[model samples]
Target: MTNQQTLPLPMALNMTLGESLAKRRTGRAFRANALTDDELSTLLWACAGLTGDEGRRTVPSTLNLKAVSVWVLRDDGTWRYDPAKNQLTRSTTTDCRRASTTHQFDFVTKAPVTLAFVLDHDVANTIRESCFYVDAGTMGQSAYLAATALGLSGCIRASFDHKALGEAMALPDNLEPILMFTVGLPEGK
Candidate 1:
């Protein structure tokens, strides 16, 4: 609903299935280089955006629940990913990426883009609680694969203060932060 900038990404990129799979890994170190807005857009689309008029999405949800929403943390601030429109709506002006993880993870805060996967438990009420993890896992893998194919390094991290992160981001009561995926270009050797 707010004014958001949508970047124009190439409709297609040259990547084979095997290449993308091989590229998949948890990248803890990242370059400070900023990810182009277009790459960010494409990454979001590949994760959960609507892919057709019938309203099917890039990733499958339980009963088409589509309960998982992504919040992107960048230098500017935290923004909600609007998959329907393929844009990011600014939510806060403060960068909370540093506060996301506990000290044990050797957390890297320099990644240009950090994606927080927030699940709307209310929407998936019909499904059992145990099943939510399955849905979240599927979405996470999709995001990882997409990032690899896009020539970006990505990692799905579960290390974070869930309650604090949810409150800091001012997320809706129904939305629970599940997984955090940090993405960016790799630093030169």
Candidate 2:
């Protein structure tokens, strides 16, 4: 959100809240195809992109701290989303599929995109854990609705190698990987 180069997103999709809610659902199976730039932009916007001035986020957080950091993980690379700027700054160029998903399921990596929600666990440990869960789940649900509205599919999964992912992503020492939402077109599509 600071001085880093930013990628401006396209206009967000116009959809009623009711329509997006009705379409909301979880997805596991994924097709190996790249998402259009617009689709990707909309998905990230729905997750944590800025919707207004003063660093407001789509999902509400405890004290508006917005501790959750979204990392867009793809086969080619990974990036951190800057909500205020509505942009992504590259995190790593090495392939991270193996680091993004767990042994419990392979579909996570199979999906074209995995949005990883990381946090400062030390801060979480010092506070009520439920707040963290609520905030993270709020962001995850936003992604699901966005995917559905775009006729895409996604899954919020907890089964991942946290240590490996953090190591692979070269996360800062203070941060900890918490949850992941995988998104992509269905196989039949």
Candidate 3:
């Protein structure tokens, strides 16, 4: 494990659920500028961060499997979000943002950060495979709303080369990539 980068406390996301839903849309373009730690923290917390003392997450887990793990890909490197500690642990020194997208959607590489959601099948036990996908979608919607509330833009996609991404991130055999949410400031912002 590498040194953990503690995230700044997220700003209060006061937007009503309806408002966020109304504002949310697929990000068509992105600026190259990086998101601040505050923005990244809020966006990530909304995706899968721990809530309350009992250890529930922001997004509901099917069968409470809590099988999805979010890995952040950036220019600097890849990092795994550790919700319990509210920090990011470095996963690899390789920059895998471009590899996280297919050639048709290569534009996504322009975004400063891409969040890859991987499902830990071992943690999921014998549940149906579809259940893990549901968990990923749940977190994706949360990320969309949170991005809208934070004035950031994002696009959730499952179009990447799964095998290549897994190798680039150095994921263990048990982890399966479910989706990737590319995020950043909108162009001309």
Candidate 4:
């Protein structure tokens, strides 16, 4: 995926949902290895990629609004997952991984991929504030299960600086940053 903006992921999964669930584990540390383009593509697809021709996705959404925006922060830069195209669009070229999270944990930057699950306030408010969180959790779980299947590790964190993150991505005021996920090879890998 070097010098490339879009990546196509394999449609078939190597592991079943049950297998992925049983193998799922969290990590607090990570190796410096980078996640392959296919790995990132599959993970993002499992998280929020379109699953059908009817605009359905891998995870359920609140009020069927599909209001959550998945942001990918990597060592190279940041991108926003566009489900419709099944690709990631470059959000910035600044390698804002460190600024993606509040400097609370060192692993945030060490991990190869950091996902910020943002919410569109207008669409989420249509149902309830809690709906957004519920949808976000489902997406996060999708990422975790995919990582487990891929022989990788990841963790979800609530600690992040909203203002700084917004500025880092140059995001609009309507998109509210919520939960986050940091994933990569475990420390020894």
Candidate 5:
């Protein structure tokens, strides 16, 4: 475990569902600006944090099994998103952006933030693989909308080197990368 700073997160915005839905778009042009810590906290909370006392999350998980985990990569280092506590725990101090697939937008490496969604295969099981993907898709879309509502640009991609990422992040064999969402300010119109 690495040094971490636990900060309080703000309440969810009052944006209407239609507004969030209409604002949703896959933005590949990300401004080379870092996202504020608060903004990052809000985005992570909106994706999978606990929203109610019963431990209900912002995104629905099948059978109440929160089989997905979020790992964030930034210029500083890699950290794991702990929704239970609404904080980021440092995982590694290496920059692994170059490990991402080349055909992806070239600016990905320069983006301020990248979110990787990891699925717990052990929890999903062979019979629930499809469900896990569906659940992850829902969470990923929520992340996109949340980023949009926060006035940030983001793109959801699934073309990263999973084996390398898993090893670098020190994720258990049961955890597998499902998708990556690169987020930052929009570069230009």
Candidate 6:
């Protein structure tokens, strides 16, 4: 049976958009500290969580397909964030951070949380591949602002072995990995 972790209500990130924009900067150096459930919830929500009852999102979906999904990877397991439920459904017992990064970026392995942006073809069959990437890119930008507002460090990467990661997460064929956003406490903090 798959275990589900209910995310706590997201903490309001206090920084303004301008402040967050000014503070936002990509950093790959992450301290080996796991994000608290609250932090992860807030970040995930910022990335693509639902905002209204009409099934809208923090980031826009091409033609409102809402096909994008965020997969959370940490030392404990791999999880898929269900925005409708605000919960994470565990997908595997093994950590798949290594598969989420390229050989050149060992720092990714040291980060405590990596969010895999994915596109579900089943939900977006009519959309082109470029649309999938644009949607994911917007979510990545949101994640960067959220991390900065939360006083965390993060970097978005597309250097991972997609095939390896898909297999590691045991993702269904319909789900395609688009990007990886890794976040954690800044190193030396």
Worst 10 residues of 6 by lDDT: 98-107
> Model 1 TM-score?
0.90
Model 5 clashing-pair count:
0
Question: Where in model 3 is the C-alpha error above 4 Å?
Answer: none
Per-residue lDDT of candidate 6, residues 22-129 (tens digit): 889999888998999999999999989999989899999899887888999999889999998999999898798888876845788899999999889898887688
| Models sorted by lDDT, best on top | 6, 3, 4, 2, 5, 1
What's model 6's lDDT at 135? 92
Best TM-score goes to which candidate? 6
Candidate 3 positional error at 49, Å: 1.4
TM for every model, in the order presented, reads: 0.90, 0.89, 0.95, 0.92, 0.91, 0.96
Model 3: per-residue Cα lDDT over 1-189, one tens digit each: 455799998779998989999999998599989999999999889999888877899998888778998989998888999999889998788999988877744557789999999999899978888988989999999999999998888999988888888888888888878899999999988
Model 6, which residues run further than 4 Å from truth?
none
Rank the models by TM-score, top first: 6, 3, 4, 5, 1, 2
Query: Taking the tens digit of each residue's C-alpha lDDT, what string does model 5 give over 1-189?
Result: 445757478457667778989988988887777888788888888778888898898899878878888788887777888888877888777765555444674778878788888899887776557787777788789888888788888888887788987877777898888788888898883
Maximum-lDDT candidate: 6
What lDDT does candidate 6 reach at residue 88? 95
Residues 74-180, candidate 1, lDDT per residue (tens digit)?
Answer: 77888898877777788787786876677633435788778888889788877786566666677788778888887778788787888888877877788788888
Lowest-sum lDDT 10-residue window in model 5? 96-105
RMSD of each: 2.2, 2.9, 1.5, 2.1, 1.9, 1.3
